[model samples]
Target chain A: MPKVTFPRMGESYRAFRMLMNDLGNEVIIPPRPNKKTLDFGVRYSPEFACLPLKILTGTYVETCMSGAELIITSGGSGPCRAGLYGQLHKKILNSIGFPVDIIVFEAPKSHPIDFLRKVKRVNSSRLSYLAIWECVKRGWEKLKYLDDLEKTTHALRPRELKKGSTTKVYREVLEWIDGAYAMKEIHEAGKEALNTLKLVPHDTRRAVLRVGIVGEIYVLLEPASNLEIEETLGNLGVEVHRSMFLTGWTRDNTVKETSGILSVKEAAMPYIPLCIGGHGRESVGHTILYARDGFDGVIQMAPFTCIPEIVARTILTRVSREHNIPVLTFFLDEQTGKAGMSTRLEAFVDLIRRKKNAPVSDNRIIVG
Target chain B: MKAYMGIDVGSVSTNIAVLSHAGEILADLYIRTRGRPLEAILAGLTEIAGLLPAEVEICGCGSTGSGRYLAGVMIGADVIKNEITAHAVAASIYVPDVQTVLEIGGQDSKIIIMRNGIVTDFAMNTVCAAGTGSFLDQQASRLNIPIADFGELALSSSAPVRIAGRCTVFAESDMIHKQQMGHKLTDIINGLCEALVRNYLNNVGKGKEILSPVVFQGGVAANAGIKAAFERALGLPIIIPRHFGVMGAIGAAQLAREEVEKTGQTLFKGFKIAGLPYRTGSFECGGCPNNCEIAEIYEEDRVIGRWGARCQRWDVL
Candidate 1:
């Protein structure tokens, strides 16, 4: 059987690895993206390509270098550069002498049968339909558990009495979830993790700033690429609510079809009448939703030269003006300095706090 | 008799300002950093200390600008703020109804949009150096004219030529071409100012609503030529505050006062700190593959501060 490898995105790799493993294919999960990973990608990638593309290419190269013969990655069917990443990666890898079979899953919207066929290829065991269904069900359970642990950590980080306690508990819980072999064990470990998080002392009285983070999925999910923005925000006493999750994105793009995706498109209609590809529409839609839901501020993070997010950003300025909600955008690249980013974040937080605490008659609408 | 002190240690300059309880500037000094922020800060502090009366007490101190953390640690600042917040706060105090603040310092420029005395939107020009003060200074010297005289000369021009100001290199070559084309020196200078103003408005002020009561300040505010160009570009009267050059320091001082008022205590290290020996060094951490170069600040061989590691391994100590 061919050894199949997939790039890491948050905790989605856990479910992907399990599903691939259960299907009797030898699975090799590339190491978590770190500085070395980013450096490799940066060295091989076009200078102006978005950070995610470079990182993904780097992961493929690393996995291929480690003797993996087959690479599985997603494909997009939109105007965004992401749709072409798979083709570009294959070309770049082959030119670099790393010959490997590449499987680019077709977008379910255009080629549902092809997507199903590609998925079934991972099931080399040729198990009974019931067995395959059971394997998928177990994989999903673990994915949901991981997502829940992250959500709890996000909520508790800003409120924890002890600085860094939430992160400590979050790391331990992730370990527990990753180590669990059975569905029952995963649920038990998740419950124990939630209980452990709850035990951390917290201050409920402090008026914490609530911020909505909307942006490109890779930059949003990958902590190393974004310089740990969530952790930085949490430490600065701001509670962050991210608009994207791995399972949520997967469901919206595949199983649910247009149901969950339509609401966001509808919300973004007044601002962006057309989908500009990638997560551009979703970024605008989520910001408007967050503003209407009374978030203190919205922050949009995207890689430099990211066309889709740039289009969304220009529209967001108008959204911010019309709705009276503050919006800050950060364009991340390889040369982005941590200190500069931190300074901007600090200034933004201070601005939000001052606006929130100001007297009501100041002619500024209190959004949160 | 008590005063709050604010220090702004920037890459190009170090500024210190002392404010009375009524938020009045008592003493302020602006000194070139000359690649030595520590020495510049010490010299600034020593100068201010010598100018103040014996009865005046230094109650609180704050730090801001790029070197804020280092200066804050060295001065024992009660409050440490980023340049944006410090600049916004200071601009607000100078013009209570300020809606827009255009700050062009030595190496960086920023546009801060305000609504109801609160900063609503802001953009900084860290990536581009064309629209900043240093570029203007460079042009002034290349023209064989003092930077102080360049602005006044520009104001005297009857017809200002157009110079491409998208980037420093292009603008410099364009200026040379115009000079060879036999344009009047004053016309060329005025055109340079207009080019910088155009670049700033397009880059830093892009997609931002510039509302008046617009207050323009920073080291670059001294240029009457740029001020006139801004007024023409925005079609509004640009107000330069009384203490334009030291606004960041002033804002830092104001923030220090606010912090001290709330806590009724200050962590000021006193003027004697100027005499202490401080040194900074860096070493690459090998704990992980990141290999972050951790910087450490030493006072008489005792490490006072350490930073630059991405992970918490070197941070917690």
Candidate 2:
């Protein structure tokens, strides 16, 4: 069986690892994207390539160096540069003389049977179809459980009486979830984690500011890329509501092709009438939804030179104006400084706080 | 009399403002940083200390700007704020009913939308130096005119020539071409100001509602040419507040006062810090593959601060 490896994206990697392991393959999870990973990626990647692509390249190189024979990454088919990432990454890796087989699970929009055949090839385990289905189900359950725990952590982090309590608990909970092998054990661990979170002293009286974070999935999920924006906001007494979750994204893309009502595309209609590829439409839609949901503010973060995001940004300004909801946009690149980001975040949080406390009769026209 | 102090150490300039308990500006100093923030900060502090009455005691202190962390550590600031908050706070204090604040500083520019003394929304120029005071300074030097006279020269021009302001490099070439075509220097200067304002509106201030009672400040606020250009661009009276150049420092001081009021104590090290021996050094941490450049600040021989490490292993605070 070929040893498989994949880049990390939040807790989704754990599920991927479990699935790959069950399929009779040894899984080597690449180290979390860090300074070295970025350095490796930036050195070889095209200078104008977006941050995610560079980081992905770095992860692949690192995995290849670590003797991972097979690399599995998702594929996109759209006007966005993401669609070309698979081919580009394969070419870049080949040019660097890295020995690895790359498999991209592109959505079965055109060649349905080819996608099924590719999936069957990856699943080399000679188990019954029922057993394979059960394994997949268990893997999904773990992913869902991890997502739920993360949601709880997000809600409780700002309200915790002692700073870092929620984070400490969250770390312990993640370990508990990761350690559980069986479905029953996973359920127990999740329940135990939720109970542990409840024990953290919370300040119920404090009015926590709510802010929604929407942007590229890679940056949003990876802490190192976005500088742990959610954690930063949480530490600043803010309850952050993220627009993208791994499970939610999986469901949106695979399970439900048509997200009819309360959809991001529908919400983004007035501003961006068409899907301009990538998550541009979703970014605009989520901001509007957040505003309508009475969030104090929304932060849109994207990689520098990302085409879809750049297009979304121009329209976001109009959305911000028409909706009368404040939106702060950050374009992250290798040159982006932590201190600069910190300053902007601090100022943004302060602005939101001031706006929240202002007298209701300020006479400005209100909009949803 | 007790005084609160605020220091803003920016890329091009360092500003210090001392304020009394009644929110009155007691002493303010603006000095060119010239790549030496420590010296500029010390000079501004010493000048401010000398200008103020001996009876006035320094109570609380705050720091803001790109070099805020360094300044905060050096001054023992009670409140350390970003330039955005500092500028917005100062503008609100100066003009209580200010709905919009267009602040163009030495290295950056920002559009702050305020409603009823509170900042509702704000946008800063992204990694661009075209819409800043530095660009104007460069243009002024190129035109063989002192930066002090650039604004007045711009205001004097009746027929301002058009210059491309989308990029600094393009704008410079456009200015040269206009100059070669026998355009008046004042007209070119005015044109440059207009170009900057247009760039600001199209980029930083894009989709931002520019309401009236607009307060313009920052180092560039001293330029009448840019102020007039902004007023013309917005078709609204741009109010340049008193002490516009030192507003960031003033805002920091005001925030420091607020901090002191809440805590009933301050972390201020006092004005004596101006004479203290301060030094900064950086080294690459080899603990991991990250190779983070850890910067350390020394007061005399004791290391008072350390930062820039991705992992908290090297962080002092």
Candidate 3:
């Protein structure tokens, strides 16, 4: 069996590992991205590449160095620079003497046979197409479970009586979910995780800031990419409402658009009116939805020089104004300073809190 | 006799202000940090402590600015806040209906938009300090003119020349080009001020609704040229508060007073903290590949607090 590795993106690595293992390929998990990984990426990759690409490049390098024979990463066709990242990573890795075989997973909609063939390359067990589909379905189920766990954690974090307790439970639940292979075991683990989370001694009466996070998917999901923004906000007593999740993204891209749910296109039609690639349209649409839902504030985070998000950033100004909501945009890159980020977040929280507590014309408090 | 103390330890300056229980500024000291925050803070504390009457007692203490955490730990602050909120609070206190706050500090600049005395939106310079005080300081020295006189020279200008304000390097070259083209010194200086104000408005002030009753407060608010430029650009009279330079410190003190009153006690360690021999040391933590530089504060060789680690492993306090 060929040794294969995939770049880590939040909890998606777990699902990818499961899929690879079931396909009978030896799976090598890349190190969780850290300062050294970022340093490697920044040193080797082009300075202008988006942060996710650079971080992925660093992950691939480290994985290859650790004796992995094959690297797998997602591919896309869009105006967003993300489409070219896989190729860029491959070139950058090969030039740096890694020379590992790279497989890019494109959307089945665009290249069904190519995608299946690429998947078959790592299907060392020579599993039938039906068996491979089953493995993918299980992986998708794991992603759904992970996202559910994350959402519950985000909501409970602000109201927990004991500080850092929610995070502790979240980590323990994540470990159990990762270790479970049987669908029944995974389902039980998820149910137990929710029950445990519900028992985490929370004060429902506590007045917490409800902030919506909208941005490119990679930066929004990856803690290292966004500098642990969700945790930082939660620790500051704000309930984070993320507008993007991996499972939702996979569903939107791969299957029929679910009706009745707030469609990104329709919600964004008023402001953007077009898909500009990446999550740019979604970012705008979500900000509007969050504003209409009376969120205290919205934070738009994206990699530096990301064209799609740059468009979204501009449109967000109007969304913020028309909706009377405050929006803070962060362009994350290697040069981003930690202290600066914290300061901005603290100030943003104070801004929304004051707005929430301020008396309106009727002398009623606006608690959002 | 009861007072609150606020300390703002910034990259360029360390400001200490003492406010009586009634929010009256009793004593304020502004000292250049000069790349040594602790020393500057201690020096400011010593000066302010001496300036206050012997009967006065610090009932609460707060810290704000980039070095706020360090200052807060050192002073046993009841409240620690970011500079944006501190500046907004101070501006609202001075002008109850303040709608906008333009703060240009040493290394950064901020534009805060307020509605009904509450901060609605705010932005700071992102990854660039192009039109901030530091750039002005460098330009002043390059022109062989003292920083204090740079504003006056701008005020005396008859015809302001146009200069690019996109980046510091480009701005400097543009100034030199106009200077070599025989533009008067005052004209170039005024032009530079206008350029910086334009840059600030287009960058940090981007998309912000800058309304009337706008207040400009920060270390750079001392410059009349920038104020005049802001007034000209926005077509609204800019109000420079009496304690504009120490507004952040004043706000911190005000917050401290509120916190102490709510908690019914103060965490202030007293003015004697200035005399304490505190030592600071930092080391790269080997626990992870992040190699976060863990900063530790010591009192008489005993570690009092540790910070700067990304993870909780080295976060003992």
Per-candidate total of colliding backbone pairs: 0, 0, 0
What tens digits encode model 2's per-residue C-alpha lDDT throughout A1-368? 88899878877787888888998888888777777788899988999999999999999888888788888878775688988887788889889998677888777655567677777767878766688778888889889988888888788889998777887778777888788777898789878977887788898788999999988888998877887788878889999998888878776665445563247788998888887888888899999999899999999999999888899888888888787688899998876367778888998999888877877845667898
Indicate the residue-level lDDT of A41 in model 1. 94
Ranking by TM-score: 3, 1, 2
Please tell me which model should have the higher DockQ, number 2 or number 3.
3
* Candidate 3 regions with alpha-carbon error over 4 angstroms: A260-262, A361-368, B286-291
TM-score pick, better of 2 and 3 = 3
- TM-scores, all candidates, are 0.93, 0.93, 0.96
Best by lDDT: 3
The order by descending DockQ is 3, 2, 1
Q: Taking chain A of candidate 1, what TM-score results? A: 0.95
Tens digit of per-residue lDDT, candidate 3, span B1-317: 99998999999999988999787899998899999887888788889889999999889999999989888888889999999989988898889999999999999899998878778889999867887999999998888898998888899999869999999989999999999999999999999999999999988998888999999999899999999999999999999999998999999999999899899999988888889898899988888665777888886677767877765676554
Report model 1's TM-score to 2 decimal places: 0.93
lDDT (Cα) of model 3:
0.87
Per-candidate local distance difference test: 0.87, 0.86, 0.87
Error of 2 at A327 (Å): 1.3
- The model with the greatest TM-score is 3
